[model samples]
Target: MSRIGKKPVELPKGVSASISGQTIEVKGPKGTRSFTAGDDVTITLEGTTVKVTPRGLSKRARQQWGMTRSMVSNLVVGVTEGFKKDLEIQGVGYRAAMAGNVLKLSLGYSHEVNFEVPKGVTVSSPKQTEIVVEGIDQQLVGQVAANIREWKRPEPYKGKGIRYKDEYIFRKEGKKK
Candidate 1:
């Protein structure tokens, strides 16, 4: 038995869920989100709680049981509270700014790098050294942050570059001659 799957997802006040076959849709103050479970799992709405159960005794069904429950839970949270990712820029002259839908980054390069913000996700720079990615979808927000960090990953030697707010860098000792 799956521990997580055993627990039904509770619907908070002002949030609602609707089920259609294998798909479940959740709507809340933030936005609306939905998820479709695989054939191995069954989704049901019980009062204010949502439940997921495997359709068979197969290994694949067991594996999907927990995964499906988590996906449904994410849908509820996404519609209600949403998701956010914070990025911090390190190193001299490294900074970020939002010009409309474009993010301008200066990371010790000769030319400024322009990153076009995609739809559904909002990217902003509250401070020159900080970037905030916000959206209803957790995966999209994380992917966008990762893409921005890819431009200038933090180096172990000096720990300089873009990184998550709470991330810790394993600093390496520099050469001493």
Candidate 2:
């Protein structure tokens, strides 16, 4: 049995869920989101809670049981609290700024990198070195942050580049003269 699947997801205040066939839709103050589960699992909404169960004893069914439960939980949270990812730029003269729908990044490159902000997500630059990505979808928020960081990943030597705020870079000793 799956431990996570055994626990039903509770709907918070002002949040509602609807189930149709294999698809589940959740709506809250922030927004609305939907997820479709595999045939191996069944989804049900009980009053203010959501439950997920496996349809059989097969391995795939068991796997889907846990995954389906987690996906449902994410939908609830996403509609309620949403998701956020923060990135920090490090290095001399490296900075970030927002120009309308574009994110301007200076990562020691010869020219500034312009990143277009996609819909359903908001990108903000609170400071020259900080970037915040916010959205109702967790996957989209994370993917956008990763794409921005890809422009200049933190190096081990000088650690000069863009990285998540909480991320730690492993330092490497320089070669002897």
Per-residue accuracy of model 2 over 85-150 as CA lDDT, tens digit each: 999999999999999999999888799999999999999999999999999999999999999999
lDDT of all predictions: 0.94, 0.95
Tell me how candidate 1 scores on lDDT: 0.94
Q: Which candidate is the best by TM-score?
A: 2
TM-score of each: 0.98, 0.99
Name the regions of candidate 1 deviating beyond 4 angstroms.
none
Candidate 1, residues 1-177: lDDT per residue as tens digits?
A: 999989999999999999999999999998988888899999988999998999989999999999999988888888888899999999999999999999999999999999999998999999999999999998899899999999999999999999999999999998999
**Each candidate's root-mean-square deviation in Å?**
0.7, 0.6
- lDDT over C-alpha atoms for residue 140 of model 1: 92
Query: How many clashes does the backbone of model 2 have?
Result: 0
RMSD of 1: 0.7
